[model samples]
Target: MTTAPSHPTDPTMNAIGQAVAEAREGDVAAARRKLLSLWSGIGVTGDPLHRCTLAHHLADLYEDPAQALAWDIRALDAAGAVTDQRVQQHHAALHIAGFFPSLHLNLADDFRRLGSFEAAAEHLNAAEESAPALPRDGYGALLRTAIRQVAEAVAQRDTAKRDTAPGRTA
Candidate 1:
């Protein structure tokens, strides 16, 4: 999974990003505590950007695939409510279109990990469909790579299952 980029100007987001970085560096417990604290501050009815950012990072804190999928869904729902005016006011460069790819990619991966290849493929398709709206930059490349990797993994797993089925010959 790719590291979430930081928004230096937003303290809450910066803190969340820092926690995520700490988690990536092998301090997951600390990161989870920090994120939970932030989540408490930004409740369910909080601003869309905060909800989206917090949920996106919070999903990574879960060891359980199902829990992570739940958080990804929350993030996607919050992203849908984030408007361009809010982005401009907050000086956030995030576009709702850009958020979909990451949210769907994460959901796809979670579904694949849970042995749900059809759901995974559906999310992968959503990610691909939203890819073109992403800015043509390194972040976009990373999202594209993640989408491809998940798609390939899902296909390989499906093929393996087919090949091992009863009465099937190689």
Candidate 2:
């Protein structure tokens, strides 16, 4: 999902952030291991915000489209259960609405990489429809641009992963 400043008071979120940071630093396996451990403890019915954030970041650690799709799906499912209050509790600037575009964009990208154009288009459309919820800032612009690029890829039936796709180190 959209990366918001971490709320240090929440250990789960803090751990998730650290794992994400590790993945970003090119140690994806370690990050994935750390996150999986956290996920095991969180369980399926754990805090929605924690599930959403963790799954979203965890998805980025996978190079395989199908694997990423699974975690992205979990992230989207958890996002559905997340409340604005919960999101704002983590970062005052965050809103549950603002999470949808990135969530859908990631799903669409994964589906596209898997050569599921129809499904990709469906989620790409959802991302575009939710675009207005994003702030008029860098993150908003990035997701909007990614949506357009994914739409084009879907039209061309291109299954090759984009260089920019989160095919993080394994």
Candidate 3:
């Protein structure tokens, strides 16, 4: 039942927000530059929260699906390392359970985009399994809808591939 922090003013959060805004504006390269600068400060073994957030945003910057998948994997790894103390200190609920859904969903999207339907299905399943950890609010609902859409798309693509393969007819 943890609520979002009343004050979301951390430097890392601010940087992430700015980068996300830049990406949303279609300036992904600029967003990548901003995130890379922050990533350097965070380093490989930096705070898990910072690493996860940075890597997740960094993934969106890449035009290459494989590169984005790599970053999403890093984000999922860092999310697993996030500590409860860090979550409390940040006044946010970033436990692995809460983080996994989005991480897996993003990974699923990346895999689907790369035409790796099996990998995409695996991650989509993981996302669905971890979804209850998310806050039961508008954001969570939106995420759930997104997950479903991605799952449906993957299913359709897989079926289409199967039907079009040799010796198969639609």
User: Which predicted model would earn the best lDDT?
Assistant: 2
lDDT of 2 by residue, 25-61 (tens): 8788899999999999999999999999999989888
**lDDT for each of the candidates?**
0.75, 0.89, 0.74
The alpha-carbon root-mean-square deviation between model 3 and the true structure, to one decimal in Å, is 7.6
Model 1 scores worst on lDDT over the 10 consecutive residues at: 161-170
2 versus 3: better TM-score goes to: 2
lDDT of 3 by residue, 1-170 (tens): 12244336578867777777777777777788898899889888998878887788788677576887788898998988987777667764546577788889888888887888999999999999999998788868867887888888798774222221111111
**Candidate 1, residue 79: lDDT:** 85
For candidate 1, write residues 5-95 as lDDT tens digits. Answer: 5556778768877887787777778887898899899888888888887788778777677888788888988888989777655554655
Model 3 alpha-carbon miss at residue 78, Å: 0.4
Pairs of residues at least 3 apart in sequence or in different chains that clash in candidate 3: none
Give the TM-scores of the predictions, in the order they appear. 0.81, 0.97, 0.80
